[model samples]
Target: MASSPLGRPTRGTTGTNRLRRNDRWIAAADAFRRAADPLVVDLGYGASGVTAFELATRLQRVRADAEVRGLEIDPARVATATAQLEEVRAGATSFPADLRVSFARGGFEVPLPDGRRAAVIRAMNVLRQYDESDVAAAWRAMAARLAPDGLLVEGTCDEIGRVASWIDVDAAGAPQRFTLSLRLADLERPSIVAERLPKALIHRNVPGERVHALLVDLDREWDRAAALSTFGATQRFLAAVSALRDQGWAVQGGRSRWRLGELTLPWAAVSPLP
Candidate 1:
């Protein structure tokens, strides 16, 4: 049997709850919870599989039958993750019993047994090492491994998960929405997420681009809603998002998600400049 094509390995830096925002967003997504097979893939889960385990825990809250599988191009990383799973099974760690998580040695091809497909694939910080031009090919490859009603979430975030952004793609490999999550305690501007945008939109954060205008408008609204901060950052964010929606920016989700420092907008509202 021929081995799968090996893609570039990531820095492999990961920590507990490093992807909490993304996992929470996925758990709340109707598509993820409604899938018959709620299998989630944590692509490039780094040197440790803790994030994958955490993802399983978060999703299981919404869909009790959810399962998480961590994939890494490096076989050694897979071995490490497997060992971590064993420790969890033996009650050596604080892992939950309902947390069904596993590890696999795979690449962008997403080699899985029995032609299994996933309902959601979270590829965080995996594409930061690759050229921006290669993102579409990787997206297509991973999207191909999805179940009919699946999602491909790809993005980057800061080391401690303070700031993050991702693009959601459907099983058909079409980009749907872009989301940004941040720690708003002392957030200076909403455009700070520009640095963490997915590879597809990071470069497009410039004048004349839809994404650029969106971020600019977001910051403007954030400033305008500063009065709401007297109530809370969440309130201010919700108000800002509401303002964006009123301005015709297709902003999705409501106060429930906004409270967690999350804002999602349609891809067309931030598509790259031609």
Candidate 2:
């Protein structure tokens, strides 16, 4: 018999639009846009396949052929998602009737039929339960299933999807970038993302850690940019991010992405201390 799925069940927490930020990020990713086969996997998609449906809906706008495969370790979750998909197919749900989405039983192994490799594997909030030591192995298992130049996006987000952060891992299982995205409206500090960080950097947010230092500088600059709040939260965030770059953080992206409350940096900039 085939080996069992390679991960534990998730907490099953999910809500509509809870992963909207990540979906937007993935939809804009080159891995999906330029893939010969835009097969994306929503690994460990919690108790609901709503995320998968939403992902496909968003991606279809960019690539009509984009397909999403929602994978769960629990057979019951798979059944439930399959049932929901039936509703979608019948036009009882808001999703398109021809939405290219499917559900299956899988985990980090990311079993795909016909030996098809994925262009992008998104694992939001999936690794929060695993030990930090388990992160590298999980990354390898998931990344190994990627097509050439594919991407593995792993991260955590809040229940309402207001605050989020994720890492981009290449097919080699090597992390490339770290990104923090938030809802700038009514935001207190950028460091709020520390709570929802990926397992790899969650516990590393302490003194002397690069991530810790990044958050500290981010918060400090946000405070210093308080004068710009009168213009709007977006202005304040832009000023703060510009200040971070001035301070030599090597912040990525231009004003467009920053206006969306996103800050990205090379993974090495915030990698855990040795």
Candidate 3:
């Protein structure tokens, strides 16, 4: 029942695999697989529908009946993406035919055909244009349209998908966890992701804050783990995260996720700037 303040349109930059990290995480989450209604919405999928098509392909591996709909505020983008979808279909591009990917013109209202409720909504890089104050309201608005037990994955990422962070929100609009995914090769400090943090924590990366301290500590551990570089960047990152856990931070997940360049922490550990 809420709505965005409706800011000016974005440049609509997009590309294939730009959201691969988020898509892969969503596909593996129990939230998507357990849903009776396997409808997923790719909100504000930019000028291209490549991410939406990729989302459908990834989700279908878990829920074969899954459907992905790409929503854009600009009608022209919607039309363009629709035409592209037709071409892919006509060429027998090996996409999930039963997945039924489509595009529609809609803003944060998330207009869906037949008033269907979504089992999951992935709104990546869509809110970077809005003021931080609008984030909670936007989450409430979108989460309200989710089916019971649905999830709302909202966050931002850098170009080329090298660094990304997202918050997992429940149907009640409460943030459950924050996940940061990055590429560890040519390694710099892990905290470099502070620049790419979600809108909520981007500005909170300063002294005295938990996020700031977390990043600081992560950098320290990363330096200490530099000795593990002999094994590889992945191994060094695993060691850094392990050190973070040993330091009593409520870091979640295990080596499997860490090896994939991801680190998920409880939201309470790093809320937002005051």
Measured by lDDT, the strongest candidate is 2
Which tens-of-lDDT digit does each residue in 180-271 have in candidate 1?
Answer: 99998878888899999888988888889999999999999999999988997878888888999999989888777888888888888888
Off by over 4 Å in 2: 1-3
lDDT of 3 at 61: 79
Which candidate number would show the highest TM-score if scored against the true structure?
2
**Residues 142-225 of candidate 3: C-alpha lDDT, one tens digit per residue:** 898888899999998888898889999999989999899988886587887887888877878989888898889989989998
- Indicate whether candidate 1 or candidate 2 has the larger lDDT: 2
Minimal lDDT window, size 10, model 3: 1-10
Worst 10 residues of 2 by lDDT: 1-10
Q: Each prediction's TM-score against the native?
A: 0.95, 0.99, 0.94
Report backbone clashes per prediction. 0, 0, 0
Better of 1 and 2 by TM-score: 2
What are the per-residue Cα lDDT tens digits for candidate 2 across 132-175?
Answer: 99999999999999998999999999999999999999999999
Ranking by TM-score: 2, 1, 3
State each model's CA lDDT, in order: 0.88, 0.95, 0.85
